[model samples]
Target: MFDADWPHRLHSAEQVRALDAQIIAAGTPGFALMQRAAAACWRALRKQFGEVGALTVLAGSGNNAGDGYLIALLAQQAGWQVQLYWLSEPAGLRGDAQLAVQAAQAAGVAMQAFDQQAEANGVLVDALLGTGLSGEVRAPYRAAIEWLNQQTNPCLAVDIPSGLCADSGAVLGAAVQADITVTFIGLKLGLFTGAGPEYVGTLVFADLQAGETAQTAPSVAQVLTSDTVPRLPPRSAACHKGQLGHVLIVGGDLGMGGAVLLAAEAALRLGAGMVSVATRAEHVAPLLARLPEVMVKAMRSAADLQPLLARASVVVLGPGLGQSAWGISLASAVAASDVAQVWDADALNLLAAGTLRAPQAPWLITPHPGEAARLLAISSAAVQAGRPQALARLCGRYPATVLLKGVGSLLAEQGSAVSCCVHGHPAMAGPGLGDVLSGAVAALWAQGLSALEALQLAVWLHARAGEQLGAQGRGLAASDLIAVMRRLLEEHAPCRT
Candidate 1:
C-alpha cells in the first residue's frame, strides 16, 4: 500500500526555502542540490516527452535559470540540439545562475538574448521565473512569458512555471503554460489552488530527499487526496437508526425546493440514520415525492423550525435559501439553535448581512469566494489574492469551522490547521453543488465525526464524487453526486454482513 500521509503534506515557498537551507547546513552543497533539481527535471522531461531532438530554454536571472541551463546542458550532451534564450542579460547573471551559464558554456551549450526574432519550439523549458514573486509580472519578463506561452511545443517548468505565484497560485499578469511541471522540495500549496492548476500541467514532484531527510518546517495546510480519505468503523448487524444520527435540512423556500431535496437526499444517501426537511410548506409534497425516506415538514414560523432543530442531531441551514421573509424566518431560528449545523448559501449571505446570527453550537459555514468576501467585508478578488489570510480571518470572526469553496477548497476550525481538498472537478461549478456539500457535511457531523474530521472526509467524498461524475462530461447536474456518494460511503464504511 502507498503511504497515505506523505502526499497530503504541502509547504509554502518560504518553508521549502527553509528546508533547502536545512539541507545545505547539513553539509550538502547548494550547487549539488541545483544539480539534483536539474537531473530530476531531465528525467521527468524524458518521461513526458520521449526522444525529442531539439530543445529550447527560456532562462531568467534566478536559481530557476540555473536549473534550466543545466537541463540544456543535459540535453546538449545527450546529442540533442539545444537553444537558450536569455530572458535576462546572460553577462550580469550571478550566484547559481552564473555558475549554470558558465557550466552550460563549458558543455558547448549556446545562449542568446530573447527578441522578436526568437522562435521557441521542440519541447520548451520554462525557467523564466521561480518562486517568491511579490508583484505583478513586469513587462520584459511578461513579453518573454507571452512568447513562451504561444509555443505549441510540450513545455516543462523547471521548479514551478514562471509567473505562477508559488504561494497563492495567482498567475502574475502572465504565466507559462506547460505540458508538465516538475516541482522540487515540497509540493507547493499554490499549485493546487487558484490559477496554479491551469498553468501547472500534470504535476510531478521530486522531493530530492526532502520528504524524509530535509527538515521541513510546519506547513500551513494539509492536502486531501484519495489515500487520506478517512473512513468510519464498520457497522454491526445489530446497528439501528437510533445508533446513527438524524439530520435536518432547513432550506428550499417555495421556488427552491429542489436544492433542499438534493441536500436531504445526499444526507440520506451518505448514511444519515434519518433525514428531515423543514422547508416551505409548498415544498413538502415534492420533497416527499422525490425522496420518500425524508420526513418533510412545513416550516413557516420559528415555532415550526425549532422543533425540527431540537430533534435533529445535525442541522444544515441553507441550500435554496433566499434572502426573503420565509428564508429569513427559518434561518434566524436555525442561527439561534445550538445543534451542530452547516450554514450555507443564503444562510451565509444572511449571516454576512447580520440578519442571521452566528451559531452558538458546533457549526460550520460553507462559503464560496463571493460569500467569503462578504463575510470578511473584502473584495472577492482580494479574497482570492490572499485566501489563507481570508480563511484565518473567517475562523477568527465566526467561531465556527469555515469551508471556503473554490479550486482548492479549504476547511478550518479554531485551534486546528487548515486542510485543502484538491480533488474537486470544474464541472461542479453549478448552482446546487454547495447545497449537496452542506448536506453531506451535516450527515457526517450527525454521525459523530468532529467538525474537522467530518469536514475532511465529507469534503473529500463530495469532491471525489463530483470528479467521478464529472468525467461523464459537461452539464454535470448536482444530482449526479447521489449514487456516487452512496457507493463511496459503502466502500469506505460497509456493514459487516
Candidate 2:
C-alpha cells in the first residue's frame, strides 16, 4: 500500500513553474508562497534531524535560493546559530528573491560569500541550483555542490538536489547528495526515475497549498501506487479453470532452464488457469518435478511449438531463449502466431538483432536498459541518461505495450501517459527476476486484462513483492518473490466474492 495523499501525477519542471505562476496569478502573493515553502523546508529539516540548533544555508540567485534565505531567517528567529553562504551575488537577485534576502539581512542572519574553504556546520542546506538547470553544472555552483557533498553533516536539499536534472534525472556533472529533499507544488518526474533515486535521499512533498491550481495542472506521467494500479475483480463461485485463460511460456535453452521455469511458476501462481512450458527437452523433467500442474513439453524444433501456441491464450516469449539456431527458430515461430505475447530476455535480444519480426498480436516487451539499448540502437548509457525518452522511442517503434524495466520501471503504450513504478528495492538486483515479471504480465493478460492494464498491474505487483521481501537485506533469490506476489495479488484481488 502507498500514501493516498502523495501526489500520483508527475510533472516536468516547466509544468511545475507554470503551476506556480497560476497559483500566484490566482491571488496567492509570490512572497507568501515563498514563505510557505521556507516554513515547510524548515519543518522537514527539524523533523529529519531533530533540533540541531544550528543551520547552514547555501543560496544562489534563483527563487530556490529565496527559500533558503527565508529558512535562515526562520532558524535565526528560533534562536539557532545560522550561517548563510551566497554562491551568487545578492545584488543580482530580483522580485521575491530580493525581498527574501532583505528580510534575512534585516533579521540579522549573517551572510557571507561562498568559497572553496567554507566549512559546513550543523545541517548543510543545498539551495544553489533548482529546476531551471538544462546544461551541465558550471563554475562556482558546481564547486558549491561538490563542497556540500563532501560534508559529513546532515544535509537538506531545497526543492530539488542541486545539479540533478529536474526533467530527466540526469546528474548535471555533479549533484548534491542530500540526506533529505523538500520539494514543493507538484512532484517532479525526475525525482523517481534514473539517477534521481540515487541522489534524492528521502523526499518530502509540500504543495505550498497550491490546492486547485495544482490539481488542474497537466502532468507528463503518473506514478504507480496502491490507489492508481489496476486490480482484478473477484471471480464468481461458478468459475472454473477453463474460464481462466491458458499461458504458454516458450524458452529455456541448453543451460538456462531455470528462466522458463521461473516464468511458468509465476504464471501458474498468479492465477493463470493452465500454464504450459515449451522449453528444452532437458528442462522438461526438472520443470514437471517442480511444477507438475504445468503442461511441460520438450521442443526439438520450432515445429514442436505450433500446437502449444495454437492452444494458448497468451504466450510469454524469451525467458532463456538463446541466440542459437534452436532459439531463433522458436522465436520466429512465436512471432508468426496471433496469440497475445510477453517478450523478454533472449527473445528481446533476438528481436533487437532482427532475427524475428515484431509480433502482430497484442504483446508486451519487458527490457532492461541493456536489452532496451539493443532494441533502440543506442548505448545503454544513453538509455539511462534519458529513460523516459527511450521508453517513448520504444513505444514508437513497436505496436505492443512497452515496459522498460529497471529501478523505477516505466510502462507505456501508443498515445498513453507513461506509468512509473517506484516501489522496488535494491535487493531485487539478481537474475530470474525479469523472467518472473514476464510471466506475471502474461498471466494478467491471459486473465482478460487489456495489455496496458495487465502491464500496469503486474509491474506494481512485482515491485511491491520485491520491496516486501527486500527488507531481509541481501541474498534475495528471484524465486523468493513468487509466493509473496501470489499472496499480494490475492489480497488486492480476491479469488471468490
Candidate 3:
C-alpha cells in the first residue's frame, strides 16, 4: 500500500487484467483478490464515516458488486445495520461476485433488488461500474447514479466513480460524485484530472496485494507531485550571467506591448541570463518603461529580428501577437529559425492556420484546450473528452514538445511519453498565466534541458508556484505570482557541489 505506487497499481482495464493474471500465476486465488478488495472498501468506509452503525451499499452485477457485497458482510460482522440494494438482479451476478453474494447471504446481510421505495438513511457505498465502462452509462445504472446523487448522505466510490473514463477522466454520462474515493490496484489517470478531482473527493488508494512488478507495465505518464519534480541545475560562484543563456521574446503587436513585456519579465525573473524583446517599434518604449532591465529591440519586419533570433539561445513567441499580416509574417520567420522556442497564443493559432511550420530546433507549445482543438481541427468538446489522446495527437503532428494547459496541464513530446502537472490552484484561471509559463519554459530550455525535460519542469514549476501563492487565498492574478516563481527557481536551482 505504498501511497506513491497506488496510481500505477490501479491501471487501465487491460493493465488491471494483466496484473490480475500475474498475481493468479503467482498462485493467489481470484476469490482472494475479491476478498482483499472488499476489505479495503470496508476499511475506507469506516475510516471516512467513523463507525456509523447503519449503511446502504449500492451493488451492480460485476466485480464492483462483489466488493459491495463483501463490504456488507464486514459491516454485519461489526454489528451494524446494513442494506445491500442490488440495482441488477442478484442472481445475474456471476464469478467471484456471485460467491460474494452467497457469502453475504450466509452472513445474514440483508439484501434486496432495486426497490423504488428505498431511501438511503446512512452512508452510501457506490459499487456500480468500475474501469470497464465505455461510452454513455445505460439504463437503470444511469437512473441509479442520478438517484444516488440526490441522496443527502455522503458517498464512497469503489475503484473510480462509475462512468468516468479510466484514461481521460471524462464523464461517460451520469457519474457518481463521491465524498471519498477508494481506488484499488492502479491509480487510473482519470482519477486525478478532468472531472476526476471533483467527483473523486478525498482520494485513497489500496493495492489489494499488487506489487511493484505491476508498476512496470505500459503508461503514457503519471501524475506530477512535488516529490516528482527535479532540482534545477546548480550554479557556482564562478558562474556569470553569460553562462545562463539569453532568451529573445518575439511578439507584442501594436497596442499589445503588455504581452511580450510579460514574457520578457517572466524570463528574467526565472533566471535567464539576459531577456530581450523584439516587437513593434511602438512597444519598445512601453516595455522599457515597465521592465527597465529588459533589452527591447524595435523590429520593422522579420529580417530586422533575424540577428537577434540568431543570438538568442531560446525564443518565446506568440504572446500578444495578433493575427494580422505583420504578426503572421513575423511568426513565419520565427518558425523558420533554428532557435529553440516556447510557442504560445497567436503563434499557435498561426501554426494551426498552416502559415507556420514546426520548428527544426527544440520547441514547446503551450495551448489551452481551445487552442489545442484548433490545432487538431476538432471541437473543444472533443479535445476535452480525450485529453491524453489530444495531447498525443499534438505531439505526433509536431515534432516538438507540448504543454496542454488545463486543470492538469499535460506535457508530452512526439518521441517520448506524456507527463501531467497535478499541482497548481484554481486561482491560476486568471489571465497571463500562459505567458508566464511560456517564459519559464523558455528559461529552462536556455538553461540546457532537452525539449521534453524542459516542458515537464517548466509546467511543474509554474503550477507549483501558483499552488504556493494560492495557499493563502484565491483570486491569484498572474502578476501576483512573479515573486514565488523567482523564489522557487532560486531555492531549487542546483547548488554547486
Candidate 4:
C-alpha cells in the first residue's frame, strides 16, 4: 500500500499521459479506463455530499465528459436530482465517450445541450476539460467557465477544473474555482504550482489501482514534501561544534546591514556549527550585540572577504546586498570563490544586471516571482503562469539548483527534476522569510547535502515552519520560524551512518 500519510502532490500533464499509457498496457481497455474514471468520480461525489443533493455536471467532448456522464448516472440511481450540460452534441462523442453517453441515457440521466440560460446555482462537477488542453481557451467555453466561477455553491471538479493548464496550473483564460478536485491516474503538476493551488481546491488523487506501474511513469515534475526534505545528521552528545559546518553570510551594505545579520542569526539557529557575517564596517557593533555567537567582520572590500570566505563551508550571498559598487565588488569576489553558496535578494539583482557571471561551484538561487522574471528576462505574469517551466528554464540557464518562491514554491535543477513545496501558510506573507530560507539552505549545504538536496529541503522546512506559526492565525513574523526550525531540525534530522 502507498504511504497514505503523505500529501498527494501535484503532477504534470506528461505524467498523467504516461499513467494513461500504463493503464492501457496493463490490459485495461481505453473504454474500460473511462468507466473506471467515471466510477471514481461517482465515489468522490458520494463521499463529498452523500445522496440527498442536486448536482450539475458540466461536460464536453472528450473522455472527461464520459466521466461526467457516469457521475450523473450514479447520482440519478441514488435518487438525487442530476443534470448534465453537454458543450458539444451528445452524438458527436466518439468511442468510449460515446459509450458513456449511451450508458447514461439507458439509466435515465437528464442531459441537455449548453444554453446561456442554464442555472449554475447548484454543486458543480466540472468535467468540461481535462489535462489534454494546451494554448488558450476560446469563446463559449470561456463564457461557461466564467459563469461557473460566479456560482455561489461549492464546486467539485473532475480531474482538473476547466481552463487550468494541467501541466502548470495556469488559467488558459479562465478556470473553474473548485472547492475540491478528484483526479485519477497520475497527479497533474499544474495542479500544485502557479495558479494550480488556487484553482484546484482541496485535491484528492486515485491511482486507479495502478500501484508500482502508476509510479513507473516518468514524472514531468515533482512536489516537495517530507519525502524530499533533506535530513540533517542527528546530533549526538559526543558531537562537537566542529562536526557541524560553518556558514558565512556576505552582504548588508551600509543601510542594509540588518538583512545579512538576520541571515547569519538564522544560520546559527538552524544548527550551523558556526555563523559569520562579512559586511560593511559600520554594521559590526550592532550585529555583535544582537547575536554574540555570530562572527562579525568589518570588510573594506572583496580582498577583506577573501580570508573569511576561505574558512567558510557555505556562503550565503545577497540578503540586502545593494547594487552599489561595494555590493558589486563583494559579489564578484563571491563569484570567484569555490564555496557552495545560496544566492538571494540583492545578489540576484546584481546577477540580473550582468555584473556577475555564473559561480565556480554549486549554488542555489532563491527568487520570488519578480526576481525570477528579472533573471529569466520574462514578464512576472509569465513566470507566475508557468512556474514549473520557468523553474526548469532557470535551472538550465544557470546550471544551479533554483527555488522559485511564490504561492506553491518550486525547486528545480538541470539533469535532475523539478519539485514543488506545498507547505506554506499565507501568514508567511511578511518580509524576511526569504532570508531565513537562504540561511537554512546554506546551512544544509555546509553540512554536506548536494545543492539540489539543500534547496528542496530548505523549501520544505520553511513551509513547515510557516504552517506551524500560522496555526495561531495570520500576520506571523519571520522570527517566529526560528523556534520551529530548531525543533524540526532536531526531529527530522537523519541518523548518520
Best of the candidates, lDDT: 2
Q: What shift in Å separates residue 328 of candidate 3 from its native position after superposition?
A: 1.5
Candidate 1 residue pairs that clash:
none
What RMSD does each model have against the real structure? 2.0, 1.0, 2.1, 2.3
lDDT of 4 at 392: 80
User: Each prediction's TM-score against the native?
Assistant: 0.96, 0.99, 0.95, 0.94
Backbone atom clashes (below 3 Å) for every candidate: 0, 0, 8, 6
Each candidate: what lDDT? 0.84, 0.91, 0.82, 0.82
- lDDT, residue 33, model 4: 81
**Residue 474 CA displacement from its true place in model 3, Å:** 2.6
Task: Tell me the TM-score of model 1.
Answer: 0.96
lDDT minimum window of 10 residues, candidate 2: 1-10
Write one digit per residue (lDDT tens) for candidate 3, span 103-162: 999999988876567879688999999888988999888888888888999999988898
Per residue, candidate 1 scores C-alpha lDDT tens digits across 1-497 of 11244466778889888888888888878888889999999999998899988899988887888899999999999999899998788778888778888999999998888886787667999988888677889978998888888878889998888888888887778889888898888878888887788888888888777656533467878887656656776777888998789999988876999989989988988888999998888988888888999999998677887777778899988888888898898888887777888888888899888888887888888889999999999999888877777888999999999888898888888888888888877788787877888888888888878888888888988888998888888899888887887788787777563
Write candidate 4's Cα lDDT for 18-43 as tens digits: 77887788798987888777778777
lDDT head-to-head 2 vs 4, winner: 2
**Alpha-carbon runs more than 4 Å astray in model 2:** none
For residues 1-497, could you state the per-residue lDDT of candidate 2 as single tens digits?
22468889999999999999999988999999999999999999989999899999899988999999999999999999999999889878999999999999999999999998886789999888889999999998998998998889999999999999887788889999988899999999888888998888999999999888888789988999877888888898888898789999998999999999999999999999999999899999999999999999999998899999999999999989889999998999999999998999888898888888998888889899999999999999899889999999999998889999887788999999999998899999999999999999999998989989999999999999999999999999999999999999888888886
| Top-TM-score structure, candidate number | 2
Error of 2 at 485 (Å): 0.7
